[model samples]
Target: MCVGDGILPPGPLSGAVGGKVKFNTTLSPPTKPFLSVSWTFKGVNIITSTSVNVTSPGHTNRITLDRATGALELRSLVLGDSGEYSVSIIQDGGQQTQGNTTLNVYEDISGASITGSDDVLIEGQSSTNLTCDATGSISTREWMKDGQPLQPSDRVTFFENNRMVSISPVNISDNGQYLCQLSNPFSFAEASYGLAVNYGPGAVTILGPATATVDTLVVLYCSARTFSPAAFTWFFNGLQKDVDEAGYVIEKASYSHSGNYTCRAFNDVIDKHATASYSMQIKGRLAQRDTGSQDRGQQGHQMTPTPTTSRAPGQRAPDAPDTPTTSDAPGQSK
Candidate 1:
């Protein structure tokens, strides 16, 4: 018994251009020595004479097998080289064995970009479209928003070209960083576009601590409510921060991080800004007195060192003597 076309392996069809593609098949010679071996494509003889061989389209050489070993070798492939192929071997008493395999070619997608119907959208507005485009041999496209997959809906229309995915009727809900993916089984490429679907420049609010200690971890959070495509800009001490994400992280914090932290939310199309600011202070421990009279000595007189006094709140204590007094008892230089 021998394995035939009824038991050949399956292969992938899609591939990238200028990339390699291989077609393979396994053959078992029954319990008899083979008389001859040959390969074929589309039912046409690949070689002129009977010999163990492997043939590829558009190649000058026909890969041949060791007459005594019955081995196969194939090299140098192209797009048109993809197709159905078969191998047949002769066994004892004229019995024959054959098998078949399929090959697929693939290419890459490039030049991806983003565009829209209109540059902006107002509150309670109907809709528009956001398009992601590219050029290449991509078989299909995938749409994503903020890294999540988008499905088709009445508000959403997925348009596909040779290398583009356009979402029509875009609404405020569709404002975000959108990514388009083009792919074949062998290669994939992606591009990103940002949407600032503007509605009323939403209200911005600070979500965290109003005061913190020096050198401590602090997170100043800002949230824009009732806004579409919230554009956030964070400021440290009135300077814009370079952090790109929703929040910023500070390590080994110090008093230098303390300032009027501000977050401004806006949409370019709407030409509106909603800003929120938080007063942050990094407090430190109070300094201790070097001497008890150090504070009193600052008042511009020579203060006599006296015992520190404690008084109830709102109660007054006797003032300390300013300096040594000169006096005569009875008759003096009055």
Candidate 2:
């Protein structure tokens, strides 16, 4: 209540780190033509001034005072320089005016990091939780995916003022790099995390001949598209075969080889598999036809003998001709 004429108002001031600020005070020049003004930080003298001269050895370059108004100016403020500041003005008649103000300096956020529950997400089987961490007076946060702002969907949720995010039942479309940006009035920082989605071995395809002749060679190929290459297995007639490669070969096809062939593609990363089947048919070789000409002697002449036909193995020869032959009627001949 003893403040000289209660001229200066009382309150606090705000400043940004590595920036400048001013603390204002109003005072009337003393009637005797002699006036003094002094500024103290946490009760330690920072600068002192009179009508004609000003002295602040420790803060000579960064601190200044207004001789007429008793205002204090500070340049390049730092976090350590934040505290209570007091200004006192003395008139030549021993009258004094004093006021105090609190200064708060805020620094920018630094060292931001983003973390997630799983680096590799499995499609339709995995859920992930993500968090953003940083240092400083942060006021707002934003999340981005694939260079675009992330919006909450049926399977995605946000928490902690958007500093944390949750993705449930992840799908193939959810795979990409994610970013977390932390910002304040004075500064901003960002962190990023890579998200991978492990998905199928779906839509298996089999390529091969559907039919083959006996003693002919055949090959069957199986494949599928997947995030991770799938392991292949071949099955024949409801039984597992010894072949594990994507390609199956039959050196020489036989009637016994005809059956339903199946290819199974499995991906371990996503624990998913697909199957495709093909029906194969094998046919036995056909018998060759015999082409021969029958000769009849002209005008009572005896018929000459015809050469016998050569038959393939396992083939039966045609029975002897039913008509009488010259050898059968030997007595009538000659």
Candidate 3:
């Protein structure tokens, strides 16, 4: 207690460089008035009630002492000023009390940033090291990925006072925004980095119709899974086409469009390529598939009537004449 007990509990007070701090002793003028009030650092006199500092040249203009209240203020602090401090007050009635405390000075932190071992990070096959950097003293380092706390795992680790992190065998999921937070008793700072983990150009696929009629609109599409956009190359009948896109448009299909089309996908990061092909056929017209010859044969035979049998003139008309004659009437005797 820096008040009635006149003792500062020996607890350390925090301050940053180039800042000001007031050691509130909470003391007031004694009824008997005061004889002298003095402040000391590490057993050496720093300032007196008369505004005079002896022994420490750095505290010449930065120390203040109140004879009445026994309070002391320090200004324009520096790192070298950290240490044990004591204040003694004596009243005219010969009553004296002393207070003791500790001080911890820290340099303010700033310019926090993260640096990686390599400019480009690759997935599944590449290892990367990231180090957090700042200007002044830092006591703690925290890491975050996409706003979530990042913990050490089998593939992720921290070292060098947690100022650096190592990721081995980078994965596709590692791609995200990363942040590093640095802190100390007096200051805090943060920096961000975009972690790009390049992956594949695999699972190449082509989509389109297998057959299209002549003079029809035909469109073919291509796709693949990749971290970065993949470059596409189209091929017709094993020949490289002039187009390089995910879509191939044939607004008007013709005989020339009848061939096997291939789509090749390439990723520059992994330097790998994949391909898929589609077989397309074009006809002059859909009507060409109809059975025209069979239909014509049936029409040619329609003119002829059904077949009829003819007998020789002398052979006698079969089944008798149209009208039954008297001679041919029954089995009567002639």
Candidate 4:
């Protein structure tokens, strides 16, 4: 009743993330009369009798043949439902014949976002916590730093429950790239981020000339430790000046540009601004006049560069190395 070696089409082998699956089987008649058939996946019996179907991560399906329709059907497919499937059939008391097919599943994690804020601390002060949460069927969570498995340490803590991995108490020792992974028995997925903590402004550098030519454009830069893009304000000659976010630029800078300059920054979440000041002197016309008037000019023109060193309102200065200057002028420019 049967012809040459029987052939079976490859199984679906794959399923969408949180989606259903459908399967099918084909048969060729042999010389003997029609007999029954059975199906199995990875050696796990999916159906005891010919043509069984199932879902992901398991073997479950019923094989049914309609003599009138001459067709076979499978239903309710899932990711774990993917694998090599085998079928055996016996014809009219003759020997049995078997055929094999393979299946694959494709799925992705959902709802991605960074657990920590845009900014974090890295220095050995404290641990910063970050997490990744996603939802889907067959969910799993994995943690990473610099694209690698996050290491365990006193400086770094990773807490995993379901789809969340929390990295806490961030420290300088923890500086690096971070990410989290999620998956189900059928498929896998992930997300990532980089964490750099707050320190303070770095050495202050004055822009323009150390000694500017009178009538020349006077520009001053109050360089601080670089941080997340922050609002910056420049104070020139001890007075807040119209300037860009990071540095100050004066058109037709005159004697007014001479004196101390400072730069202050504020985080979006905070009410008060932090400042960094530097003593600046312009050697041209205005600053080169009489010593007495110059001293008076310098009095109001001098500003301090240190800003509050604490991130939290009432906390002590972060453990990172801050300049010897602890406190700065409170009324300084915001």
Model 2 TM-score (2 dp) = 0.58
lDDT over C-alpha atoms for residue 85 of model 3: 86
The global C-alpha lDDT for each of the candidates, from Candidate 1 onward, is 0.64, 0.83, 0.83, 0.57
- In model 3, the runs with Cα more than 4 Å from the true position are 1-6, 26-28, 33-38, 48-56, 88-98, 184-186, 236-240, 254-260, 279-334
Q: Kindly report which residue pairs in candidate 3 clash with one another.
A: none
Which parts of model 1 are misplaced by more than 4 Å?
1-7, 12-22, 29-33, 48-57, 62-73, 123-126, 161-169, 201-334
lDDT agreement of model 2 with the native: 0.83
lDDT tens digits, residue span 215-332, model 4:
6676666554444455677776677767756657767766656677777775553233567666545555534546676556677677668865537775666676755655658977
TM-score ranking from best to worst? 3, 2, 1, 4
lDDT per residue for candidate 1 within 194-284, as digits (tens), equals 7765576666788777777776787767777645566788887778888644576666568787778788877666677788888877777
Model 1 residue 84 distance off true place after TM-score fit, in angstroms: 1.8
**Steric clash count of candidate 2:** 0
Deviation (Å) of 216 in candidate 4 = 8.8
lDDT (tens digit, per residue) of candidate 2 on 47-126: 87774555557677898787667777899888888788888887778777778878878788999999887456788988
